[model samples]
Target: MSRARSDPDRKLRKAKGRTASSARWLERQLNDPYVKQAKADGYRSRAAYKLIELDERFGVLKRASRVVDLGIAPGGWSQVVRKLRPKAAIVGIDLLETEPIEGVTIFQMDFMADEAPAALSQALDGDPDLVLSDMAANTVGHKQTDHLRTMGLVEAAAWFAIETLAPGGAFVAKVLAGGTDADLLGLLKKHFRAVKHAKPPASRKGSSEWYVVAQDFKGRE
Candidate 1:
């Protein structure tokens, strides 16, 4: 049975200042097929495939005209959207400046800032048909704390999506392994016709991350 997967374990030579954990991570990245494929495909990061897979399954990007990309740093998700829907009017926000991508309006500031949602909406100049947030709080190693913090970001993104999406729009965001908390799930269920969770194949099996897709926005009534 083990012969079904033939790639041998790859180890790295011990190097100064590289911790064992860091070495393992580096080694894994070096050997990962998706990492290599990302480079070959000219993708900024492997996370691009996660969105692609999700869209393939859920039809999220099919007719999106106006889109908002939250936490779009290296711009992988935005890149995918740009490719699949070339005419999409994309506006992305990040605390870190992203290099220019054609036809995308980028805001280099914290999405948690008081002015963020309006800025994104204003830039789009229309309700978004797709709102995407790959935002996750920085981990501090405390499992409960990390989950709570990330959930806070997801909740905020959800509210932003609800407020800014056009009728029949969709919202997709990254959430932790156990999925959206009860209250957040309730909120999504009320606002969208379909609320589903998925862990795309590109997501590391060991990672505690998944995506919550809320589709068919019920309008602002």
Candidate 2:
């Protein structure tokens, strides 16, 4: 693990008008060992470790697997997937452009568009072994609004997974932990043998973000 280094400019700025929240955020970022370690490891974001930790626990990555990554901008999670499954076929899409990375094909487009999933499926050429979504809508500051927006994205991603996943495949997606809607959970339980929520250590302590892991996908058209 790398030690955290102080930024003189940041310290000076903090001294000028440090609100409690700002100070806490700065302190957390500076003292976070994972943040330092991620920088040293060349990951695009600390969120990369969240995927790594989840994969370690779940054994999701496999050799030559076909994988789909939704909202993969910044490319941290996609990078981890490529590193773990070097020969796997990966197709990543996001509303924002991501710099190209070897061994993965990235598409820049809004996934909510009518043609996006079809385009993604065409790129894959067959049902995927895994579908991973790290998508979160831009927050509007209202907790209820944010939750609804995020849930919408999750629902859409789940629908796509249902259409494009092979039997016995997996779907992993980010969701808020207030509790998933019973309707959605019931739908997932119907199609997957196991559905559980996970919070990897790399996620910030105060964030509501958690991942839903659905395994043993039943092929349902």
Candidate 3:
């Protein structure tokens, strides 16, 4: 494994009235080995390692011809795709602005919009072999509300994958720790030959995020 971040010896000077949560987050970012590795590897965010780790276990990127990325801000996932599958037709959409990634078609549009699916499909020029979503809703501090909101994004992403993925394609999305809800799990099971959950080592141990991988699409009826 690559070297761990510098011993956590560096300290941030206390700022006036900084919240404990913010301070802890800052410290974690500074000391995270993945953050340092990402910088060395020229990845835009540490989240890149999460994708790398997942791909290692799940073989999500190999031989993909057309791919769609939802919630692609910071564009690390797209970067991984570009490097691993250089010839793959790649399109990504996000609500926030993402700087241009060479060879990736990006739209600064909401993936939840009615026109988003059609736009993505038209851009790719063919059914996607891999549909990826890393979207999570903004938290409002209430656990139930937060879960519901994020899961809603997951559900929407699942529907898009079901409708757009080519036969024998795959869908992968970020989900919370309890894994996908019953209804969503049922939908994926009906369409894919394998459905599994994975939590990569790059994910923080305390983080509730887990990923659901649905593979071998059965094609639309």
TM-score of each: 0.95, 0.89, 0.96
Q: After superposition, how far is residue 101 of candidate 2 from its true place, in Å?
A: 0.9
Error of 2 at 192 (Å): 0.9
**Model-by-model lDDT, in order?**
0.92, 0.85, 0.93
TM-score of 1: 0.95
Clashing pairs in 1: none
Query: When superposed on Cα atoms, how far off is each prediction in RMSD?
Result: 3.0, 3.1, 1.2
Best candidate (score: lDDT): 3
lDDT of 2 by residue, 1-221 (tens): 24456454444245766788988777777667777777888888778888888888887775338999999989998889888888788999999989998888899999999999998888988889899999999999998998999999999999999888999999999999765677788888899998988998878888889898889898885
Winning model by TM-score: 3
Q: Candidate 1's error at 95, in angstroms?
A: 1.4
Cα lDDT for residue 28, candidate 2? 70
- Give a tens-digit lDDT track for model 1, residues 1-221: 01122144766788999998999888888777777778777779889999999999999999899999999989999999999999999999998889998899999999999999999999998999999999989989999999999999999999999888899999999999889999999999999999999999889999989999999999998
Off-target runs (Cα >4 Å) in candidate 2 are: 1-27
How accurate locally is residue 135 in candidate 1, as Cα lDDT from 0 to 100?
94
User: Which ten-residue region of model 1 has the weakest summed lDDT?
Assistant: 1-10
